[model samples]
Target: MKKIVFLFAFGLAALFAQAQSPAKIGFADVEYIFSQMPEAKQIETELQTLQTQLKKQYDGKVAEFQKKLQEYQAYGNTVPDAVRQNTERELQQLQQNIQKLEQDSQENLQRKQVQLMEPVYTKVGKAIEEVAKANAFTMILTNQVSGLDVVLYADDQSDISDLVLKKMGITPQAATTNPPKK
Candidate 1:
């Protein structure tokens, strides 16, 4: 009985000691980091250029196919039956080619988005580490989205997002979120 009581008392003391220790917490929203970077604008421009290129490719092919169809239709019944059938088959093949082009372009666009963002995310991670160390943070977290459970409320003052972005030489276009004032 004495041993059990002593153990309970010791556990209580340990808990008290832990509660007194410094637990410096910090948080940064990485979405803001990406938005604030100067290179972010450059990336957006590049994405637009890619879209224009894909559009040009698709439109050019479609226009060429339409022109050929018009030429075939103008000849009407004067064209030999076999030759007309062959042209129709070629037109079907052209449609298939367009479908393949669209599918390939979509996949390539996704690939480009990943390629461009991966390095930016890496740089942001390193900047986050540097900011945490410099600020003597015990633990730094990203707005804490835990497996389908998001932390909806965070104190804005606790948000170190701007600091981290600045450290990375980024200028955030938007403001950081602050907890609702009670």
Candidate 2:
């Protein structure tokens, strides 16, 4: 058991070392771009409204299902077997319908996300390329799950997020242009 544990630990260490030992490496987080972009809040609001609309449109079926389920539960001990079976069947069908609606909503959300954010994402890609070229970066990466990226204490002045955002033609929130009303 000790040998097996030692071997496992050694293997994991070797794998981690290999992963960390890139010859030329850089790091940037796309999350930062999205969070900082002025367009992101507008897109998020649109996404929320779309979800709300879908829920409203499909609410009747959901409400009916809930009502039937309540009735079935209330009469569970008193109802005839055939009535119980029929209610169960209807409940199953309602669940399947709910599943289909959920799937459709998810697909629509994905499609809308692509449509709405592709342009912004494209700009971010271009900006990253510009940063890499300007800074002579060989490989830019990211470890931006929540906190600061692992960079062995590089200079904060060396961080190029501001430069990348500038290159993308994105103005600061204070300088953002207002959209014209229809």
Candidate 3:
């Protein structure tokens, strides 16, 4: 019984030792990858076009609102009490409508961006996965410069941004800059 218990403990230790492979960490800057992707440029152009259209509509509404406000200011005293109140209500409604439209435009732009970016995000994500697996990276971290940077002190040698871009068939520029470790 004692011999069997010892053997069982030894087998568990061996299994644990086999499971404890060293973690090979790698980081990729996805934003850099997106900047190198042509799809991202097209998406930006589409978003800008949508924004211009929304801006035109918004400007038209503002012009209409301003004309109404000016007319109210010019003729308000001469107008009858009921007429004045009605004009005031119309002006208030126009202001509210303008605010609502502005909010809606912002939301529409955000939605469009997400809609356009979803596929690109997926494509880049898959490429990252492939690169990580092919290179035997146990973990991959996002090295976003603008947002929450998860990596604090990664050596540029460990950067997989160029690898990811290459995996996606994008030849990385010779001048791609990787920030030095902090």
Candidate 4:
């Protein structure tokens, strides 16, 4: 009788353990998905054009500053003290302006990129959520930049990137192989 009771308790414990299985996990390469989107190409082109324009403006200012500096150096010894001092001050101001413009250009470019990509990111996020729910995934991870794998090991079958693209109305591409375990 005691043996039978022990066996029953052991069976119940096994059943409970089986019922509490780990949640299903999946991963997606969001950067890959963004690259696949047509809107991303447009954004890239727009950003490139803006960057080129900014570069030209910056170059013009730099050239102007260089010319002024050259002029000052050529005439510094001949010029009166007051004139040399004024030219030096003007050159310093120009240099500061160039630095300010460079900083502003960088900040502007970053702001524009975020503005342009915000909508696409929102759309992709929605698709990921939909795919996760439809496929019963408990959590979804994203691959890091420069091929840095945030997830060391996930089964190949657990990649839901294709499904997410499909949900976003884009055709699914072949899945890349999972990163090797650390």
TM-score on alpha carbons, each prediction:
0.73, 0.63, 0.88, 0.83
- Candidate numbers sorted by lDDT from highest down: 3, 4, 1, 2
- State model 2's lDDT: 0.75
CA RMSD of all predictions? 5.1, 13.7, 2.8, 5.3
Write down the lDDT that model 1 would get: 0.80
- Name model 1 segments beyond 4 Å from true: 1-26, 133-149, 171-182
Using TM-score as the yardstick, the better of models 2 and 4 is: 4
**Model 4 over residues 1-182: C-alpha lDDT tens digits?**
99999999999999999779888888888887887788988999999999999999999999999999999989968999999999999999999999999999999999999999999999999999999999888888886657787877778778787788888889865545444364
Residue 95, model 1, lDDT = 86
**For residue 109, what is the lDDT in candidate 3?**
100
Q: Which ten contiguous residues of candidate 2 have the minimum total lDDT?
A: 173-182
Model 4: residues >4 Å from true position, as ranges?
A: 1-19, 145-147, 174-182
TM-score of decoy 2: 0.63
> Model 1, range 1-182, lDDT digits (tens) per residue?
99999999999999999889997777777766776787778888888899889989999889978988998899989989999999999888888888988998888888888898889989989998898898888888776354222445567666788888788776655664432233
Choose the strongest candidate by lDDT: 3
lDDT by residue (tens digit), candidate 3, 74-105: 99589899999999999999999999999999
The stretch of ten residues in a row with the least summed lDDT in candidate 3 is 173-182
Better of 2 and 3 by lDDT: 3
